[model samples]
Target: MNSSLTLRASAAALVLTAAMAPAVAAQPDDPAARSTIGVHARLLGEKIVPHKLSFQNTTVGGLSGVDRDPCSGEYVMISDDRSYLQPARFYTARIKVDAGGVHSVDFTGTHPFLQPDGSVYPPASAGDGKAVDPEELRVDPRTCRYWWAQEGDRPKSASEPVIQPSIQFADRSGAYRGQLRLPPQYEITMADRGIRRNKAVEAITFGAGSRVLTSAVEGPLIQDGPEPTVEHGALIRVTQQSRNGAVLGQFAYPLEKIFAESDPSSPWPPDTGVASILAFPGDPSRYLVLERTWVAGAGFKIRIYDATTRGATDVRRMDSLAGQRVVPMHKKLVADFADLGLSTVDNTEGMTWGPTLRNGERTLLLVSDDNFAEDEVTQIVALGIR
Candidate 1:
């Protein structure tokens, strides 16, 4: 979550991605999560920005995706605003953190993303499925340009046009560069096929050694089956592709079950899905996968897993995986916010690597999408890792 989004109705946050760490001595004040294998991570600090903080005429919230800009040393955060409050855009931010704690998180600037026509995307009210819902975004370290994923609108009625999801490339200045070709599975036609709206491409990350950029749908395809239930999890495809959108490999990721029951009288239903994924900076086959589940009265349960494709099946050619024999990626729990004792973890999505500690341990940083809600918060948390 290149970057992340969230799924809270009040915030309407559908968080999309976190990751890196080095080993070192622990601090007495740090809260450590489960660490049986892979590596261990400890909380370093957390800082909350005012909800709906205003900046440059834009509401400074709904940050669904984030990445460290190797070119500017600033963190690039994408807001899933859908052009409601402003044009589709991303903001450059500076977050200073060390072993002791996070010193500060500052917004330096914001850039409006340009559509292919050299125009800003229209708002959802403009309809005809022309609005953009920008989710996870990343910097192509090689080109210093930006790559982003958006969960385009699925038609709510026959009067509404289908806005197919997209993965696109933009320059540092927010100009359109190009677009990656999406797989056919992304094409919607029937009622029970293709991607589910708001559930398409929520996670993306480039592999460690190869130019294989990987992307994942937030939930399952209509044909794949239903969403996660309390009794059983589900499956979503994570695609490995080239920058030009050439399909390289695709594997099924096993989504965990929703943690609790929803409120029968509540208007909103429960949900569980992939919030983000970060590839191991050094290992092409490994990643830190974050899964977030929301139960009506139970709130959000976020879990980071050490996932690998070492023995998973490539389902790029399969039409449906409902009952087929397939090996999904193997996963192990790395950390859980529920276990770390944070005051709250609402719609926490985007995450990236921060500065390495003096002890040689690398740090991981996370930011949340407050959905511009006054009760929610724009939060940034840091963790020390090895």
Candidate 2:
């Protein structure tokens, strides 16, 4: 796709990956089992702290894609080379961490994980690629493969472009394996935006087995408005169809109506919620959704929802994270590596849960993209999940 569309699509899709935790409800007297507004509260107001796990500066200058292996407790971060508007290289790193909040990340090697073929068995960023702005990363334990989703568009006309988010995979040992173009990638067709400029897919992750979950950042329509431009987001599940193939399911979420602005003076941007969503590990019926908001006092808001409830159950205040609150802990901008050193990159995107650390505490990590900005530095930060 063209530069404007490329920038808009990527920006809209990846903007809400980092979170500003909100205030949590007061804890009940009985610490074991307390209920708040029909939701159970446990470990509320616990003095939890976030320590840096590992930070690495890739040669590509901007990190966009991230995937964590459950079995090995290792993470793979990709530094996307979007400056030349070409296929981005994948920078793989093996992360080691302890519950005491000590983290170490080793840069394994850099490699291209896509081939020109329509199949996914070979890894090569050969010909037939526009700008490979890789966005989504998923690791499958059942099959022992790593999947990367490329965010870009292909077109039938100059005026109209068709953007189909594509995905490919690799093995745990860091082997360039196969690539798979999303099923009926054309199913997300936008007839008006030409054959190419119709849709933009961003965040992606894997579920149980061949099941994959992904999101389309916006709807087919684009409207001009204030600085905080609004767009649509969708959630879809894809299952394997062949030996190494997949098919899209009918179950897709159109988030336009999910969190619409209720008051005209609310000042909340339209189509606010719905950018990145992750399924609850043990429960297939629950999901954690990251809602994008750039308004005053609000940067990134993450909420937990019961898949059955179909509504936001709780919200986290990641910006003002103090251990005082019982429900949603808050955090502020302590340090952003990009702004601290690298000047060219800024937009923070890409988040995933790593294995548990000290005292069986799980870890949550977020990655930011420099967008190939000349003065910005790309970084990855890890936090202790409560």
Candidate 3:
């Protein structure tokens, strides 16, 4: 199941306050160089639309992941439809970005993801016996092939079977090629161990020159520790693998306390997790991680953090993070979407580096999943980064 559909709303009063509050700028002084990265975001535009944005028979709303194709200067977006609405698929789009903001977005085409058997996924009612819940999408810089992550569904009962999560490779046309093997820790089972349901792999990116593929889990594994709470944070493992799927290394990433803007004391903890990641150009050890939290009544708390694995402990050989001393990656606040001065923010889950502007500064683009809700919207937000 897609996790964004489960987000609840927060109190109206608290939502208003959070929306209007001033954003605190991030400033981390560099000890050695005596200079800060000075990262900030200027809102280009927030394009919001109805849930039924369609292309022929398919609806283009459940956008879980997005990436830019430098070769074509177009963007590719993956929908987490689970073959229920249509065969599992992705779409190519052309978005016009200018000084004013995003002027328009046009869908060029949609391609169905083919299975190894050379058949598209059947509808959910068909009982096709295939487990696919596409969560993240990326373009393999080395081959221009499309790579996607699927958070395979967990067994609902003892009688049901478990489907392990996977990262799959496909051509631009979405033909099945091969898949990357995940470590045993990511396997799902009937026992109360391993990854929690709907909380497996959620984010993936190519590091620097595309030599390494990094993936992030949505939450900590059962043995890692408990889920994050208001008072305590949790650690999730970030794994790096070679383009051909050889495991290289793994490090710990600390997740901040759950963001419940409406009611921090609310009994139910809102869904908070890593939504997207973008590797720094020519730097495999550094990345920009996007964390999004949605409270029931209030709204979204979206933040970007600059993360580095330098000097971090490699937990690949470690059995568990609990009762063990480990050094997690260093993270610094980059920008808060709330501070970007947008009128409204939806479930922003997908992000990637856009084309550089005339001034040579980089741009970031984020897309939101409406979950096919009438009250919600599918939004594409552009930001100027420096």
Candidate 4:
């Protein structure tokens, strides 16, 4: 289903609450599991002033993905603005964290993502093929360059054209360097069996000493069964590629049902998908997958699942997953955003590991995309992980 439709449905039932309460730790299913990581999230008491954090002469909102620059203490965030409000761009910001929790967030600067011809994306209009829908951003651990994902647009009608999804690299200054050559399965086609609209590649991460780059689609390809529902779940492919863009392997990750039967439903089944993925600090095969959902009247539901491809079957060679016997990654629930007691969870989409706090624990940061709506707020929350 289209994300814009989901957002519009959710906005109709918006309910505001007080500040978020401290998060309660969730006990792992297995107390002695070393392969799994336990996490507890607490909403930062102070926000970055929703839809008002400006940098480089633009209001910094619609943050979809965020990662901390290893070299600098600053954090980089990608905005999915699609060159509507401004040219495609990213922003650098400072996030303060301590024993209590995330203290504050401040914007430092913004840089425009350049096209091959060395120009910012032109404003969206008819015949505008240069515009991009930037989704996730990551700083290359090897060269400190920035790699971001674009969930290219899918056509709405027969006359509308399609955009191909891509993962491109940019210098620290946001100059276009190159892009990864994606598999043919990811291409948006006029055929019915392809990436659903607004549901292309949305998550990307570098791991294995920065030798391996992994990207996951926001939902299953049209041929891969159906979108997850309260009765049955769906499967999405996670592709691992070399830094130079060669496909290495691909595995399946099962998406849980969008919502329970008791929860609210809309004209369309509320969509659920992997919003972001992060490789474990020392394990290339392990990752923390953030899955989020937005049901019309029920609001949002987000969960962090610790997943491993250690023994999962590689499906890269398979032409279609619809009827294949594939082994999915092992996943365990790590944290549920609802348990954090947030007043209202907006469109939470991005996640990354922040600097270690003074309390000697690893910090995890999650950001929300307010969709640039006045009724919603851009929220940045921090979680303490042991």
* TM-score, one value per model: 0.89, 0.55, 0.87, 0.87
Regions of candidate 3 where Cα sits further than 4 Å from its true position:
1-38, 123-128, 261-269
| Model 4 C-alpha lDDT per residue in residues 1-386, reported as the tens digit of each score | 11111001121222111121111112223323433444445554435455655567887888999999998989999999888888889998898876676678888889999998899877556444566789999999988899999988776766655678999999988899999999777889746677898889999998998999999999988877677766556778899999888998898887776565434335755768999999987777888898988887777788888887766678887666765656566676777776676666778899899877676677888889888888778888888776
Model 1 worst lDDT run, 10 consecutive residues? 18-27
Angstrom error at residue 72, model 1: 1.5
RMSD of model 4, in Å?
A: 9.1
- Per residue, candidate 1 scores C-alpha lDDT tens digits across 132-200 of 889889888898899999988788788888888888999988999888899988766678788887788
Cα lDDT tens digits, model 3, 56-119, are: 6798888989999877889999998888888999999998886578888889999989999989
> Comparing candidate 2 with candidate 4, which one achieves the higher TM-score?
4
Alpha carbon deviation, residue 3, candidate 3 (Å): 24
lDDT of candidate 4?
Answer: 0.77
Instruction: Name the 10 consecutive residues with the lowest summed lDDT in model 2.
Output: 1-10
Q: Candidate 2 — which residues are off by over 4 angstroms? A: 1-58, 82-87, 96-102, 117-131, 154-163, 171-199, 209-275, 293-346, 374-376
List ranges where model 4 is wrong by over 4 Å: 1-48, 260-269
Identify the leading candidate in terms of TM-score: 1
Shift in Å, residue 100, candidate 4: 1.2
- Report residue 80 deviation for candidate 3 (angstroms): 0.5
